[model samples]
Target: MAIYMDEIVKQMLQLSCKLEHTVLNSDSEPEEWVLLLDERQYLMKQLDEGILAGEVLSDHQKMLLAQIHGIDQRLQPIMLERKQGVEKKLREIQRSKTAVDAYHEAGPSAYGAFFDSKK
Candidate 1:
């Protein structure tokens, strides 16, 4: 039983590192990053569930958990950056939507009206 629990903890630690890398600075498309971030959350949920299921921890298991804690600490900034990135994206979308709405309300400006009619 303890061995099984130890194995689960090791898996969680690996997943934690995977998640940290996924959230690290990247030049990938936003949608790709979004998918990665979503998967990260799923991984984290699984880790939490596994941790909760373990009825008891041996000293070895505790050491593994300490490693997980270190990984989590390393992930903190990346997670916060992900959150801030999401907020910034939402704000940009809002600004773009407002510009589109205002353009419609004002109708075409002289520049658009002139170019829109012909060729």
Candidate 2:
């Protein structure tokens, strides 16, 4: 049981480190960020399963959890900012589409006439 808990904690620590690096690196692509998030979720699920299985964390494991919590605090604001940016972009795109659709619905000016009597 100790071995299993240790392995889970180790993997979580490594993944948390990787996630921190990815979040800090501006050059890291969005795809990579998303992949890391998915991995993090999976690791969290594993941790949950461990707890549900009646596994007790050692003192060291508790310390590791605290470290992970610290990383999470740092990550939250950055992730929320990114999410807001994406949402803003989507809203802009939607507005542009609506304008284009309205223009198309107008379907050009059909009733127009111009006359010059003096030639």
Q: Estimate each model's TM-score.
A: 0.65, 0.77
Our model 1 lands, by Cα RMSD against the true structure, at: 5.7
User: What Cα-based lDDT does every candidate model obtain?
Assistant: 0.67, 0.82
Q: Could you say which candidate leads in lDDT?
A: 2
Task: Tell me how many clashing residue pairs each candidate has.
Answer: 0, 0
Model 1 residue 35 lDDT score:
68
Candidate 1, which segments miss by more than 4 Å at Cα?
28-54, 108-111, 114-119
Residue-wise C-alpha lDDT for candidate 1, range 7-98, written one tens digit per residue: 66676667666655665647534465466556646655755666688657779878877887887788677667767998999999999999
The TM-score between candidate 2 and the true structure equals 0.77
Q: In candidate 2, what are the lDDT values of residues 1-119, reduced to their tens digit?
A: 77887887878888888988998887766788788778878878888898999988899999998998899899889978887988999999999999767665644544563333324
